[model samples]
Target: MNAEIIAVGTELLLGQIANTNAQYLSSELAQLGINVFYHTAVGDNSSRLKDVIKGAQQRSNLIIFTGGLGPTKDDLTKETVASVLSVELEHDQKALNQIEQYFQRTNRHMTENNKKQALVLKGATVFPNDNGMAPGIAYKNKDCLYLLFPGPPSELKLMFDKYGRSFLLEQLETKQFMESRVLRFFGIGESQLETEIEDLIDSQKNPTIAPLAGEGEVTLRLTAKDNSLDRVTEMLNKVEEEIQRRVGTFFYGYGTTSLHSELFKKLQEKKLTISSAESLTGGSFANELTSFNGASLVYQGSIVCYQNEVKEKLLNVSPQVIKEHGAVSFECAKQMAEQVRQTLNSDIGVSFTGVAGPAEQEGKPVGTVFIGISIKNSKTEVYTLKLSGSRNGIRNRAVKYANFYLLKLLS
Candidate 1:
């Protein structure tokens, strides 16, 4: 089924609030094998909203709406929809009782206007709202299905996930369930990954493969649709294995797993403690790892040696090394990693030293970065990179590269 999501609110148009509801609904609908072709945001004007609804109804089978369901005067979603459908709003007793109990529990007086929240279409599937006053409405008009949901994210998510989904599921005659898996890769460009599997993507039918590129990483989302779980799993596994066979060395983890989390897991599994010495990144790598739970088991600490004086004094990077190879060089990065590992008494030490954008430093151009990794019984390794972006972007990319190298080493 195809759908168009309409966000009804002036605040969305004015940028006072975001239309996140459209994103949520689109994702949910995609899992049900429903295609979401358009997302439109219309203000509180009734005539314009009706026009949008008419246009959507002409193009799509499902018309989903978020917002404008309230007791206030500007809340005209149901009223306008009723006008278009040639139906009048009818008071739902169960909804009205729930609203009364809500006001009573909160020790508030229930005004007559509060009854507006309980009004539904003449004949509609009513979804009870445990989180708010307004009840959700789902109505069918000929070949089109109209769904109205509360604007508040908390209420809308609960109502849809708990009740609305079941209603839609009952209507679907042959359920074609879709499962998607994201394969994340670092140290590889999106175009490179896509080109490697261009033939596979071109020939794919049952499982669709899509490549997405981010700042310093790439992801391939493979979606498989099937009636049986085992058949879908088998198809997905076969495709995943084939993709991995082609580019398995660069592929790290799957399904929202990132470089930092993968590195932490590997370090914890090996019972190895790690420390970091940062330069341009300013401990961002350490901060990222520290945000995860149970990080203290493997994350020792980090030293932000942003200045040359601190690099020389705290991280024990020699002035001669800085003078000879510069602070952004492989020598300085290696020394920083080695010194931090020894000083912090960690099994693994990582370091980042770089020249971010806006200005060159020590005869090195901007975006020149060196990431260092040192293990107790092994030699220190330094990887050099020439990134592109603003100063903050370069620094962020430097931190990400540090995490990527750590994950690679641990793997």
Candidate 2:
């Protein structure tokens, strides 16, 4: 089914709030095999909303609206929809009872205007709200379907998941199953990754390959549809294998897994302890690793040696090496990694030293990074990187590179 999402709120146009509801609904509809053709956001004005609704009816078979469902005067979403469809508005008794009980339970005064929350479009399927007072409505006008949800994200998400999804499924003429797999890759540019698998994308039929570039990473979403679940899974596996063969080295874990989480899991599984000696990142690498639970088992500790004095005193970097090769040099990183690992008695040690700044440091240009990895029973390895971005971006990417290198080592 072709669908269009209309977000109704003055706050959205004024930039007071984001229109994330449209984004959520679009993703959910895609999973249900519905095509979202357009997203339109309008203020809480009747005339403009009427125009938007009429335009949506002409082009899309399904129109979904979010926001402007409150007890205030500006909450005109249901009224506008009812007016456009030439249908009457009636109060839903069950919703009214719920609202009354809420007021009584809180010992608050219930004004006459508050009863407006119970009003819904006539002949519409009522979706009772579990989180808030505003009830959702779904109406079918001839060949077009209209769904109205509340403004708050909590209310809208619960209502849609509990009732709205099943209602849409029942409305579909044919039953089809859809499955999607997201393959995540790091340490590669989006353009290069796409170029490697451009043939697979162009000749896609049953399973579609769509590449998306995220912050510091790229993802390929493989979506397959069929009447039988087994056939859909087979199609996805086939496409994934071909894509993996082309760019498997850069591919990491699946779905929303990040480098830190994957690394933590691997360390725990292998029972390896880790420590960090952070210079430019200032313990950010340690912070990312320890954010996951049970990090104490895998993480030993971290030493933030931001200054040369601390590097020498804590991480035991020689003063001569800092004066000659500079603190942001390979020798400094290597020493820091080995010393931290030996100091904390961990199986692995990682170090980050770089110039990530507003100005160059020690005759080195900005974005010049050095990452060192030292593992027990192996030689130390240091990787050099020349990156480009703001100071914070460079620092963040440096930490990510450390995680990626360590992950590769452990794998």
Best by lDDT: 2
* Cα lDDT over the full model 2: 0.93
Tens digits of lDDT, candidate 1, 1-411: 788999999999999998889989887887786778999999999999999999998999989999999999899999999999998899999999999999999999999889999999989989999899899999999999999999999999999999988888887777877788999988788888889999999999989898999778999999888878778889999999999999988888898888888887888899999999988888788898898899888889999998899998898889999999999899999999999999899998899998886889888999899989999999899999999989999888888787777777777
Runs in model 1 lying further than 4 Å from the true structure: none
Q: List clash counts for every candidate, in order.
A: 0, 0
- Model 2's TM-score against the true structure: 0.93
Give candidate 2 regions above 4 Å deviation. Answer: none
Cα lDDT, all candidates: 0.90, 0.93
